[model samples]
Target: MNNIEFIRNEEKKYHDFCYENYKLFEEGSWLYKPVKTVMDLLPLFDNNESLNVIDLGCGVGRNSIPIAEAIKNKNGKVVCVDLLDSALNKLKEYSKQYKVEKVIRTEKADIGNYKIKPNEFDFIIAVSALEHVKSEEVFEEVVRQMPEGTKNNGVNCLIINSEVQEIDLETNEKLDVLMELNLSIEVMMNKLSSIYTGWEVLKTVVNPLEYNITRSEKPVLLKTNAITYVVRKSIG
Candidate 1:
């Protein structure tokens, strides 16, 4: 299949999986926690000033809710973008419970098709997002648009899957995975450096993790390499 088609299939599969197991996105579930990487960088945002933020693939307001709460007093707003309506609906419910519903807006759009407007946001985060763009061209275009999308001195945090091995649950054998990036840490950093030359790199980390999942009544382990980057646009 072609890149766009591959992405569509992967998205459908993921949506179905999440729909079948929607409870995992409930308020108290493990996946509902704010990402530590994002939490760590929260202090950098100026609480006194209104900030425009975007959370790509903001699953169930895990990070977006807290962010909205933080910036609510400042009249800051967070635009949440995700491919699944179910996820966005859950996020809306959580936002209301958190009392930050006014500060949060949800949009359903695939990352590959979403357009990032120039100088649009003061803060942008994509936790475990962007890696789903199966098309290298699409990924490059997104990266290219980031610098312009961010206002001067704006901050951005991205946590992406750099490498991962998918295993068949029934046989516990490695599957021929076609959906994710498999770049080494160095290569990934180099690519980011090339794309984000207008930004100052504040942090770069590569985390090695083993994720266990059950499929077909068998346990499958995924050796995952996750990369986190915190960058700020250079002052013009």
Candidate 2:
């Protein structure tokens, strides 16, 4: 299998396994580990407020289901988008089982192709999603689509533990977004401290959105290289 085909197949295998043993992970120690780590890296969220969320590259609905439950009580919704049919089906099932069907919306689209409303999301999240997308253009396009903030100031945050290389297709330029840099809660909080202050704080804290690095010049890689970025949107 080629790169694209290989990724598709690997995704299939993953879904097949997750669908069968999802219960083992759901609310279990095995499941919420990464989630806890990710949440720790985030700013505070209110329990009684409503917000909008988009789960890009939602695979097998594992993260989607929990996200739905976490946000439902807050009157928030999670739009789960993915390219694979199997993953969507599983998300639907989980939503129904968890009684979050009303809170979760599933979409069948190559995440890299859609135009997202910039700064529109109260929260934008991805779970190990970016590394698999095939095209840098498609990936960057998604970022450009995030709609500028229309309501209260919002932000976008994404974290991924993998290799990252920023390559410009138009100019063939390259930059390093992050390297073996896991955007942990500690790092994120520190960055925000420098950015936020009394009366200057915003409603959302999702910025410096985390997308996947599509290229590489080196062979050495680290597993803890997840990066988290926060970009805030201001309500004009």
Candidate 2 per-residue lDDT, tens place, 169-223, comes to: 5455564433223345454455444443321233333323333222332322223
* Stretches > 4 Å off in candidate 1: 1-30, 178-180, 214-218
Full-model lDDT for every candidate: 0.78, 0.57
lDDT value, candidate 1, whole model: 0.78
- Backbone clash pairs for candidate 1 read none
Best by TM-score: 1
Question: In model 1, what is the error at residue 24, expressed in angstroms?
Answer: 7.0
RMSD list, candidates in order = 2.6, 9.4
